[model samples]
Target: MADVHKVVFYPVGNGDTTQIVLSGGRRVLFDFCHRERAEDTDTPEIDLKSRFKDELKAVDRDYFDVVAFTHADLDHIQGSTDFFELQHAKKYQGEGRIKIRELWVPAAMLLEEADKDHQQEEFVLLRQEARHRLLEGKDILVFSKPKALADWLEPRLNERGEAASARDHLFIDAGTIVPGFSLASDGVEFFCHSPFIKHCDEGDIIRNRASLVFNVRFLADGAYYDYLEVGDATWEEMEDIVRTTRYHKNDDRLAWDLYNIPHHCSYLVLNEEGQKGDKETEPKPLVKELLLQGKRDAYIVSCSKPIPDIKESYEQVQPPHIQARNTYERYLKEVGGRKFLVTMEEPNANKPEPIVFEIASGGVTWKRSASIGAPAIITSTPPRAG
Candidate 1:
């Protein structure tokens, strides 16, 4: 426990949920989607609420430092309103449930068209909470928007003459460094890289491209480690991101020590037509450069269902695509110093262990859970009331 700075990927089936515990006990959550029940028999059924609380317990705290909703997809923000404190009420504060100190969201989440994309009441409530925070200028950080947010803040902010002041802390645009932020006391800098204004225009309904991708750079021992979290980005967006970062002379921004594969290893992220197992469908040149052109100790984490051999699972070739996994595996082996880890494949019994990576000056190492199967569901807190 040498001041462990770690990132944990929860095994919530073919969805995304990652927790980063920084050096100083500051916790940042990427997304959250827990299954009421696992769709596949092999997948484990776990209590998401309890699992999240355990992470809170690790820091001897009762809340997350920041909870980032990469996008409003059901698999990403589905159970948030229920799991975290959504209101500033006594009842919501003392249930052993954690509070979110800040909510990081892409501007796309505020769009009315995206509401249909997340018809769940949980999402509606989350939006309400975010709106509440934005109005109060409290626990909300709006990325990539001002006019739209200003419209929401009209009458008050427009009259106060303080709107210009809020822009320093409340608003962040793509390619911009986060204002006065870090992971604990670590020299970690998070750079916002997605939800470009074009993607959130009034009529844009494609939510995947609105993902809040960030390039996280931090100093460990003496070197810098870069972690890229791109939630469900399509190849089209990936192409733009790589090209834009390169053109800006931000090549270091694209270099990664760890990369969470986009869209859960979907073949579409690699190319247009799906590449089957062992098939040599050449990946888009830009994508090859993005993944292959990384630190020698680079890692690729697949947050999805266990990958099956291409021939065995070709009939329903969706995400966790065997061909995609094969492509990554090939790269790792060829590099001879890289790793490709999958959540479900972590060793354990009765359930999959969360895949945790501990970072230090030397490099990073996998930290396995202490016990197998999901922690027992908490009985003290009453069931969430909608």
Candidate 2:
């Protein structure tokens, strides 16, 4: 029998929220978007209150060992304050508290050095807690900062003698691996794959470029487990990692069993000419090449809405807007073996409830289990050995 590793991708609509349960039972959660605030009704499936509350109850809030926030984007961090406060409040209210063993976040997201908005009160409070209170004894791992890039840019600024901007603090240094827990061992072997020192620029570009990309690898029972999670990162960020770093040189770093499509499968990451409108073009050959190189078996897209159809109007008429649906369809066709899983097809469909992936007995299987229905199981066939 194969040992088991379990992952639950909670429905968060257009934002990323996934829970990884290791073989040894340790649980790690990545990113959280508030499901309660879906009233604007931009997408059809948003039941903010139900989804958010149900997710918390489904996990019993007791399963989280590590909670990670990819960046400071509201969609990513909306639940942090709430989660923390809820746990604390529950403790005070005589309800059992969810114990978060540790908190992992990008240093740029938590530290003063990375703050571009001087007036952000939440940022200030988080920094204060992280630096003074949390660092005192609590477990907090800050991903690497871009010291080399910062140093490189520092000299240019001095030479110009213009006011040094707060943007300099946003650079993420390369090679810093966030601490991770595993089911098979004491912890999972994980490493950052992007936002290397060379990629850090300024502003949103820096945020998107400096986004932390990492891979988790472990052995559960006799089966090998591997997955990649790249937070809302773009192609420019990816190209830099491939060209400037040692990432591609190491097979372990680039390979994956499952991959989270970056930027929700948006084509903005692939071309300088942003999202192409609703028209479908042949898939970008470069994207195909990258996917082929990784040889992933499962590709997950965590988007809130149905990816815009190739024939639909472009979501954004602005320059640089790439049609997400066209990109997704083309990529799926190019990567023939891998199954593409999207979370937004049925906001209220019962056939596929919370998407569940499990590794057990030397293999993995996907199942859909909803609160109101029976579980639909799909056993995964291992990829043919090369």
Candidate 3:
């Protein structure tokens, strides 16, 4: 084998769950959406708990190198508390629960205040776990140290008889490559692109605005391929990222070979709020530029339900919107890109499998499954210059 890497996107139906297996055995999972109904075996959603456990068992492992929770949204963190062993509480430990060697979360996860009625939600529990690890000063990475987080953390550190800035190294900011992983050694480097300080520091905390976004660059035979794993960011945040990234001369971070489109292909990510007048939502000026940054034979993956071209679908309010999908397909065609894949519609909506992309020295290749009724298909894009 030629040191191939794998990126797997699950069919979570408008939710987000992506796993990146490095050329080495190390794995990093972004978001986790495990529906309870999936256990029935009849639901379209995969049984994430069973699949993840089986996958880890095949390798004789019990933990992930990095488990990043982009935001505390239900779709992103649903059923996560029951799946991963929480170091903060003994009740959540043991029983074959998967361990996270290093947990990654945005500052919002630490500072957000839960509503009284939703205080016991999974997001709150995950926040407690993240806070515990951060306080312990080990096995955790907190993205962006906004003032709100600092205010909360400084008092806690003071109570523990430690310097307020003691845990600064663990905090990663936007536009910088995450430490501990380098292309030279790990064949991958994550460049933080969003969840800037302002996003969290401003008056009220919006989960989507404070979500984590990264440009994951994979190195293979001296060539670099980018994967943009954006959370449920809206058009305002997208524009901010474009303006700030370009202003700082970090334009290359905008380029992507594999783009996980934001908000389950929601038009709000491409157009301004209340601007869906056109049947096909046109991408905002900066967003269009970002789409154009897709490299040759690039792919845009939508981690959402099937986007049908039916009459009722056009007027659908929620995500997996047909209009947004149309815009993405248009841009993919304009750029001569490879495919626009939907998680729940890959092979078929009834029993969709994970969309796997293998990265090798040659280039990226889509690994298609040949189920009984599904077509046997395998597509590989040509290698690009480093």
Candidate 4:
């Protein structure tokens, strides 16, 4: 087949680290949360950073073309500075770490006066890197510039006498397309959908509300494969996205072959009351209707611990909630789907393998090389993950 293009979802516990290897070895990482060695018995003992390096070699690429941070959550941005080569660009190079040629971040991450009460060290570093890259005129696309932030920058631009287009190439608005990649050749196209002005203009930083949700599409033989990944988005935001996209006749962007279940399968994406005293909460009608749009053979993969049927207190409710998984399961049933992969669970082994979703002419399928593990569903070298 043509050179393989795939998306590998690492088995990080309740966190995300998805690597999208487009055709021609162009790499785009969604988020990063690496395991140092081995934390628990449920996950494999493979070093995630090392595994990524080996995969990069297979594609014969030395740097990540893009690294998109959905939001500044510790779970999403953790271990990023140590893993990727950030500042080793535009200067001396000796092969130290994976260089990030381009960065995609929401405006909240770059807000100069952001509320630091909840900032994580990794997130702080990531934000600083984005800021530095923008100042250097690098390929840094600020995902969504709310009117507040945009207004906040107008004076600075006037003072510096910088033309509107002087930085328009780097600053982006929501619902607009992101550049620096193509679909026909790169095998992928990204459409921005989040960091709404309302989300950013709030008094307190609602971190999750500022996430950069995208209708990430992969093209193959003129056909498009869609995957929706929203980091920690609540049901309110999810509903608005569905209604807005459909209202604007952007339904084509919502179709998906494989869905990376958002918020680690949390019910917050379904409704505010994810659980009610050990009993799962019911999803709203619109949320249910939206999920019914899944394509045939669609799969929902949750990258978290086992979605337990029991409930926990709201104060300590970890994501990948069993109730939410049940919701996705029912939706899959509607679409004649039979697979719902959990990252921490093995196909039939002591550890979990990187769930690989390969995009080919026929359709999407999951395959595992002999090194990492085996696929419980279809097999065909979907994409090997250690």
Instruction: Report every candidate's CA lDDT.
Output: 0.72, 0.54, 0.89, 0.72
lDDT of 3 at 23: 80
Q: Judged by lDDT, which candidate is best? A: 3
Candidates sorted by TM-score, best first: 3, 4, 1, 2
Give me the runs in candidate 3 sitting further than 4 Å from their true place.
369-377, 380-386
Candidate 2 weakest lDDT stretch, 10 residues: 85-94
Which of candidates 3 and 4 is the stronger one according to TM-score?
A: 3
Instruction: Tally clashing residue pairs in candidate 2.
Output: 19
Compared with the true structure, what per-residue lDDT tens digits does model 3 show for residues 120-223? 79989999999999999999999999988898899989999999999999999998999989998899999999889998877898999999999999987778
lDDT of 1 by residue, 118-183 (tens): 655766667767766776788788877735555666666666666645644777888888865754
Lowest-sum lDDT 10-residue window in model 4:
377-386
User: What is candidate 4's lDDT per residue for 98-177, written digit by digit as tens?
Assistant: 77788888888877454677454767767667776766667688877676666756666677777545666787766766
Error of 4 at 370 (Å): 5.9
Highest TM-score scorer: 3
TM-score of 2: 0.73
**Candidate 1: segments with Cα more than 4 A from true spot:** 1-3, 38-43, 88-94, 113-120, 146-150, 159-168, 273-281, 348-350, 371-386
The alpha-carbon lDDT assigned to residue 26 of candidate 4 equals 73
Alpha-carbon shift of residue 87 in model 4 (angstroms): 2.9
